[model samples]
Target chain A: MEKRVLMKGNEAIAEAAIRAGCRYYFGYPITPQTEIMHYMAKRMVEVGGTVIQAESELAAINMVYGAAAAGARAMTSSSSPGISLKQEGFSYIAGAELPAVVANIVRAGPGLGGILPSQGDYFQATKGGGHGDYRNIVLAPASVQELYEMTIEAFNLADRYRMLALILGDGALGQMMEPVVFRDKEPIDLPKKPWAVTGTGGVRPHNTITSIYIKADVLEAFNRKLQAKYAEVSRREVRAECLNCEDADILMVAFGTCSRIGRGIIPIAAAQGVRVGLIRPITLWPFPSDVIARAAAQPSVKAVLTIELSCGQMVEDVRLAVDGMKPIAFLGRSGGNLPTQKEILQKIMKMVGR
Target chain B: MQAVFKRTAGLLNIPTHYCPGCTHGILHRLIAEAMCELDILHRTIGVSSVGCTYNNYEYFACDMVQAAHGRAPAVATGIKRVHPSKSVFTYQGDGDLAAIGTAEIIHAAARGEKISVFFANNAIYGMTSGQMAPTTLIGQVTTTSPFGRDPDAQGHPINVSEMMATLPGAVYVERVSLHDYRHIIQAKKAVRKAFRVQEAGLGFSLVEVLSTCPTNWGMDPPKSMDWVAEVMIQQYPLGLFRDPKLEESK
Candidate 1:
């Protein structure tokens, strides 16, 4: 039997990252994300790793860039305002083609709105958060166990694709506690980064890591290459969990903690004489749009309802995915407010005319 | 016949984009000579910051990483933390280090990151065509300070070495120049000492080189060199601001 340990979502992700061979962590203090930094400071030292409580988020992300460029599995985590500072580094990392992981333990904010949980960064996560024609591999984990697993996978996916992978979580997911089991992962044989700045040893020609391409034509070519890689990721990595999606009167779409709310609405709506189903997205970047299209295409699914912890962010994706196959309804509560399972059920029942 | 001096392989023998008589070329050679002398080129990682030398990564024969403006020191700290045995350094400019990247450099020094920082202080933002700089002399005129820098309005020029000397983590802080043949030789020696301080893991080491931007300064090559000696040095004095070895001897 595997040993079970109770840990906060942030700690679980931190421990999983260490298990995934992330030896360097740079972070700044932010509520709901500080536990990850604390865990890394203590545990990283024990495992012969390094963790720095950086001076600022801007400094932290740049440090991650340097470590990643030097061929280390590096990571950083922060809440909203701090993630804003990281945008500059993310753009450079994407342009230079380095691999790294970052987690945004989101708090309420347009500008330091509050420290409570919020999922207002969906567009920022799915679209480019930084100034560029690039996107990060964004993962949305609804449970602590899933958060742990995805944190480990984020490293592998980042290196495999040679880009950034963002684990987008809210303050609630970061603070909540759950029993997590530590599973020994099979050794992964990732390809060595021959392009990294691991000193030339005087034998090999020195490698240069940079994001600046002065010529317009050269930069365009590099951008095209990034687009092709993103296309491949979309084709290969779209993941969603569908529950009773077929033969339902209504289908609901959601992600992260709200997706769990989307699932609970099932039983409540069923008891109220209306059949409802759900599609919980795992990879928010390579969004499971096709899954939504399929579920909404079912003859019995009359309408699609999208629920969120923000004022209709993922609803935009659902609208894009459903593509007029079914009429869509959006129900959201922004500014640190979460709609209850029963409240979501009422929205679903209203769609089904119950 | 025995070869007395040949170019060092620490820097590649490639043409640079620097203007004629620009002091960046001289500073680059001094750093290359130090790398060759210390036998650390193969294991050294250089971080090139933004400015005219943003692309210096291409000239350095050792592995190089080009960092964003003002973030080179933080980046170097990250590299050194991971590869403590390998040597790491950041080459930055007045605007990049003293102005935009002020926080990063200050924190890196405060933490005593085991890395070397080679600062080139030319008193103006040459790449941007002579904008004001944090280390600009009080009366110097640049595009931003058209009527000459007024101490009351623009604030006093920052003495980088003197400020660095106050930090305990900064084990070696020296202000050098390339105004003439004698000063050029002394500047090379200071560069070597900066690298040696890092080699000995003696915390953060910085060597601020008083460089020239002749084109932006609107001066002829020789006049620019003379200006550095006769004018620039008055505000940024040439001397060692901090050295643990000197302290130990005392």
Candidate 2:
């Protein structure tokens, strides 16, 4: 039997990343996300990996860019403000078509709002946080176990698509402790990175890893290729967990820690005789929109409500996904505050007109 | 009845977009020669700067990556750390290195990153039609400093080589010029030596080449060479500023 141990969410991300064959971790220290760096700093050397406590978030992201270009499994983690600093490098990484994993342990922020749990970066992560035309495979984990599992999966997705992969979590999930199991999973066989900038060793034509194409036609072609990749990812990789969504009058949509709150709201609403179900998005970018629309399309479902840690960021996507088929509502707690299960249950009851 | 000379295989056989007398071509040739002689052409990755040479990836025969304006050093740092066995070098201009990328280069050097830097200091932003650069001389006139640079207003010119030499992580630092044949040869030697330092796993190494922008400087080819010798050299002197091995011996 595998040993189950209690660990912080951030530690699970680090250990899982190492087991996932990530040998390079470059990050700057920030609130709610520093544990990832601390764990890596302690054990990376023993695991024959390298941990770079970079000067700033900018340096950290660029280091990941270099390591990724050289065909190493590289990653960086930061909270809201630090992730913002990394945007320039992110744009470069996307343009260069390098595979990298970035984790944003979210804190409330327009600008350094507070070091607490908030899903304020929904649009930034799902949309383009960096400048330019690009998309990242955004994963949102609701539990510590999922955090560990998603981190390992993130590396695989990144290499599979040759694109940026993002894991979005908030301070609450990052700080929370839960029982986690470390599994000895078999290694995944990713395709050879023939385009990596490793020494050619005089074996083939020198390979250049760049995002620059001065010609308008060449750039347009490259953009078309990227769009094709995004389409394939969206078609094949949309992930969501639907619970009790079958016979419901009200469907609740949430993700990350908010989903855990929704899980609590379900049992309470059931006891009170309200048929409220959930469609929790695990992949936030290729955002399980079809699942959401189908759940909302249920004959018994009358309304959809999105509860987030921010003021209606993910609600926009829900609105778009639902297409005004049903009345949609939003409830949020911003600036590091969290909503309670009672509040969500009350909202569900009101939506049911009871 | 012999082949007098041949272009180094490290450079692609294509005409450059550089102006008739701009020393960027000279610097490119020197770097290519260095790569060829070192026999690291296959294993080398060049990080191109976003200046006049933004598309230099097309000119170099090795693996190349074009970095954002002023981010080549950071990008090169990334590439080198992952594949330490491969040779990594960043080719940057004055505006790219001295202005926007100051923090990146300084930090990469401070960390003792094992990479070579080829800094082309033309004292002006050549690509964007001649704005004053960080290395612009005090009395130099450009689009930004039309009435010549006033120190009180614009601040003093930066001697990047001297500043870089102060960092303990910087193992080899040299400032060379591409004015005449003699200095051009020396500049080539400096480029080779900088790469050698990285090949030997010495810490950060850089060769600051004082180049010319004839089109931007409003000077003809020959006059630009003279200006590089007579004017640019006086402000940014040509010499080796740091050598770890030499320092240890002393």
lDDT by residue (tens digit), candidate 1, A17-128: 9999999999999997899999998999899999998999999999999999899999999998899999999999999999999999988878988888889988888888
Candidate 2 error regions (>4 Å): A188-190, B246-250
lDDT of 1 by residue, B1-250 (tens): 9999887898898899999999999999999889988899999999999999999999989999999999999899888887888899999999999998999999999999999999999999989899999988888889999999999999988989999999999999999999999999999988988888888888999999999999989899999999998999998999999986832221
Q: How much DockQ does model 2 earn?
A: 0.71
Please give me the total number of clashing residue pairs in predicted model 1: 0
TM-score of chain B of 2: 0.97
TM-score of each: 0.97, 0.98
Instruction: State each model's CA lDDT, in order.
Output: 0.91, 0.90
The DockQ values of the predictions, listed in order, are 0.83, 0.71
* Lowest summed lDDT window (length 10), candidate 2 chain B: B241-250
Candidate 2 RMSD to the real structure? 1.8
